[model samples]
Target chain A: MIDTVAGLAADPSGSTAQDVVLRAENVHVEYDGERPTRAVRGVSFELRRGEVLGIAGESGCGKSTLAYAVTRMMKPPAQLTGGSVVFRDREGRETDLLALEGEELRAFRWNRLSMVFQSAMNALNPVTTVGRQFDDIYGAHRPEMTKSERAERTKALLEMVGIDAGRADGYPHELSGGMRQRVVIAMALALEPDVVIMDEPTTALDVVVQREILDEIERLREELGFSVIFITHDLGLLLEISDRLAVMYAGEIVEYAPAERLTDARHPYTQGLLRSFPDLVGERRELRGIPGSPPDLRGEVVGCAFADRCEYAFEPCRAVTPHLLDIAREGAAGWRAACHLNDPEHRSSVSDAEGPQS
Target chain B: MTALEVRDLVVEYAQSRGKPFRAVEKLSFTLEAGRTLALVGESGSGKSSVLKALSRLVTPAGGQILLGGRDKVPAKEYRRAVQMVFQDPFASLNPSHSVDHHLRRPLLATGRARRGTEADTAVAELLRQVNLTPAADVARKRPHELSGGQRQRVAIARALAPAPDVLLADEPVSMLDVSIRLEILNLLDDLKRQRDLALLYVTHDLATARHFSSDIMVMYRGQVVERGPSDEVILNPKHPYTQLLAAAAPRTGATRAEVRAARQVRAAARSARDAERRETVVGDGCRFRPRCPFAMDVCATRPPEAALGGGHRVLCWLQSEGKAAA
Candidate 1:
């Protein structure tokens, strides 16, 4: 029902112009493959300007699919079946990202919405100089800017990413894996895009490099005021960087809340995810992994996507697909979850007085 | 005696010219029977090199690996004693071969399980140890047929097929998802405890290392920068690099603004010191000085003497008493 931009803002605190750069409503994506899978089912959220919105889930959870849908870059076999992605441009026009086609789609890319993929290093032209690649992207987007102007801008971008400007002239092969990823990020930001979708950008890099690259990206986002749709399997990283986070399970958002709430999550899926992660700063103990694997999205999914693995899954969970509903009526801040326990009417019948909260 | 003991372990990769590249520099640790010792480091820090050297996948340039206090000079016996579970399950297991084919071959090769009843029981036991249910069905399945977690279990089961005294897991769960990650870690922990098997876990994940191992060795560029009780090293880390690593662990509860601010400070600090830190540490001298925030004049030239006590060791000029050697 959250069809309009104002409807998205109505869910929480009044979203100002400075807030909510991208708002997705009831997004449902399906892969019309040989098996015709319903990959993402009724997913919705908002990415405020200058804020990082983290989408966290295990593989095949459709967090990456959600990111792809937002960028209007969903690959073949994967089709955007329903819903709309409303993104406000710097020019103050609300563009329905899903509606764009052909030339408009190409122009929208890198200029308004950019993406830094999981293996971003692989995206770079291995033979070309990093400087030239940056220039090419910059030149393509801003044809009026001269070569000298492009070069000057490229150096600044490289320096902004904490990479030495001199090394921009070096080929992708010459740069370290971390350095190349940073260059890719710099290229994504070349056009000063309003929204940047990163699909596990630093997943391949070592811990130190991962930290460094994420740090640079965080810095860049702050300086430029671009909304970031950061997707990753590591909930820890998302929890740290994201203002709000959406936990996906089998192509659906099982939990959606502010980043702080994720740690003390009410959703069973979120709790399971939290328990699974080995904490760096905590009592050293054996982590209890969620038993069973994620369900195959290729098959006919009835009821909840997580029913097969969920400890708290009941008859209702296996009977019907739970819609994203606000869990807490008063205490929580616009917290929504697709789990049955979070259903509004379900909460009304259960006496809060004797509930576990006490 | 400890199940596996790596004494002053040094491994150097042979280069085309000049001195061989020292991958592991004078590393030493022991895993008591039924305990896990996690060796943690970044890409070039020689974590995998140590594991490979132990399993004889790669030959050590110097030092010795002792199996039951005796040097494992003959590599075959060591391979039988210690089996490695590699990171990539898909690549490690043969796709063409069925699960039973992969499982039964190792048991037969090691002579731990003979054909017929004993071999079948052992295979079932191996599957049970890693929590792969319906053992009979799993035995016939191929590597591609199973999910990532199940594939990892098959790899672990295969390692156990030989009844190895020690398990060397090189980032086994890194490729798996977070939800499934803990299952693998728990399985390893259980296997170590139940069988009294020593485990040498190599990983870059400090959090997982802390969760699984009692003792931890933090390596930086082929040298052990810090080694001690996992809690002490991870929580109250004395080394500058360890401190940075602990700080870099993405905090869950922090707002985007706070996290972004901290990330900026860390990036600035890393950039400010990266180049000077790259210049090869002076041999027989403190290697951490260049990157150290509290580097002094003595750190530039003098090698900090080791301070070892209660299964803990730290090499830093600050920890040194500055007393002249006898």
Candidate 2:
């Protein structure tokens, strides 16, 4: 079904195609119902071989939906409407992910790109021991391995993620949430996949535990040299860990930039998000959150989806749909923003003191 | 005036085994009108237990909850005096009932509003207070019709329907989106000041906790290991556990190096705590001894409270020993 328009042309993601691990090109997803919700609208980005790309947005912005579409995990009612996901193997062979089917799709996942699902830390089976569950995953993916080889691999993976290898016999109930999450991550890494997608992996956990898990993932990514696509709504956190960030609003990528530049954001929605939260290490100041909620994406959206809530929305913002355009200063690498203010003709009158250089 | 005072609060869950699990102990604090106190801790650190004991969700094994200098107040009056704003506003509001019903019943039951006309007027006023415009339209809609932030606002308005003196919020904004969190938080802060309501905030986000509250109490496994002015606790932490938390906080200006350093601190702390918790026999002294890097011989017994001046205090052997050395 996705064969149409897929494998169109290669996405130009700053980096050359050789180093790009996973490239999502113009994807769209919808939750079909009485009023269909367009969850993802033409989202695209590239994952470098050993870099971390962060996708961030609040609930209903479709960050999670995009992940589901790209990973072939979309269920009924949630349809992957359009676009392409190209996963480049370590052998430099490109496979159109959306086109994979049956056993080919099954073999593609876990062996190439694995995902540690949202709240996956607590997703371990209670009745089965941690080791047994890991062995089962190995049994499915690596049928050629002997029983002892699978057991040895499980212990090694557990140890790599900082879990005690001996605790493999323990049930999910006996281990803490953090430990359970570690086991899930270990299982994801068991196949030594080239890319690991973690969606809100540290959410709802204790601060100490959240920090500990992030540290382990970073260490593993460094040692194994696999790329990561870390998804979360915590913008501040994404800014800290991710090398590049894609800010989404109303099911569209509003801003894509290097993490540091994102702080001095080019898009008003991204700026609104940065200004929304109270800073931990700074002088206290008054903060005004973006007024009004996100616009409903269930129906036909006219012009800019964020214009109603945007502080700088003008006449053109209501009439013209803004596409992602390069808003970076001359010579700067990768900064694209979907806002009329970035357009020379439609730029807002009150220019930022640190606005982009042509 | 002190709007609410809690003394030696203890919350214990009865177990089928030998002893009941004491979820909270030695927790005592006072909330004066027009002030915000943040209780900062991880899960199972007794943050919920504290809120639960205050709102009368679970009967505390021991404690005196004093509102206006009386602990013997009736259940009905206590309910009116103390109100709670729970997390997950989607779950907090009734989907079957209209917003009007959610607020009207509480307003009339507390005698804050009369029947029919007066009740309608009062509900409109509450909705207006939360910035839910054209109260007429919002009042008729069910919880499903409203957005998450709006639902939270409705929950806040409902909590305020009875005109409570003390407001206990347990992770109220955690469920909302990143862009709308400040709207709800700023609203809560504004209400706290406008109504002079004593606010007790419970959360794990160190940054927001320190930003919103005048005082911050850091909890570890049922006991408060550190307490001080919010800025002081966050900036110059004494306890090792507090330092770990400060390191874990996500900040705007943290460079990649700083993030890596924080990660290093967390990884080291996790391993150290894991090894110590398994080997150390932490009898009754400091609950954090297992995780405390600077654990000493006297940690087996309760450490003496050391005053760090300017309303700051810490329950750690390191602080006390350092004070003696100084």
Q: List, residue by residue over B1-326, the lDDT tens digit for candidate 1.
A: 49888888889887999888898888887878888888888887888888888888787878878888898546667788888899999789999998888888889898888998988888888887788889999988999999998999999999988888999999999998788888898889889888899998899899999989988989988888888888888988877778877887777657667876787687677767763245687666667677787677776664554656656677676676773332
**TM-score, chain A, per candidate?**
0.92, 0.93
User: Model 1: which docking level applies?
Assistant: medium
Going through the candidates in order, their DockQ values are: 0.71, 0.71
Give the alpha carbon lDDT tens digit for every residue of A1-358 in model 2.
1221232134334577789888887899999999999989888778889999999888889998888898999999999888889999878999999999999999989889888987754577888899999888877888999989988998899888887888888888877788888888998888999999899998868887887788888888888999999999988889988988989998988888888767778888888888877788788888777888788889988999998988777788888888877664754466788888888877745466534322
Q: What interface Cα RMSD is found for model 2?
A: 1.6
Model 1 C-alpha lDDT per residue in residues A297-346, reported as the tens digit of each score:
77878888788877666567787877776655454576777766666555
lDDT of 1 at A248: 88
Per candidate, native contacts kept equal 0.81, 0.81
Q: How many clashes in candidate 2?
A: 1
lDDT, residue A265, candidate 1: 78
Native contact share for candidate 1? 0.81
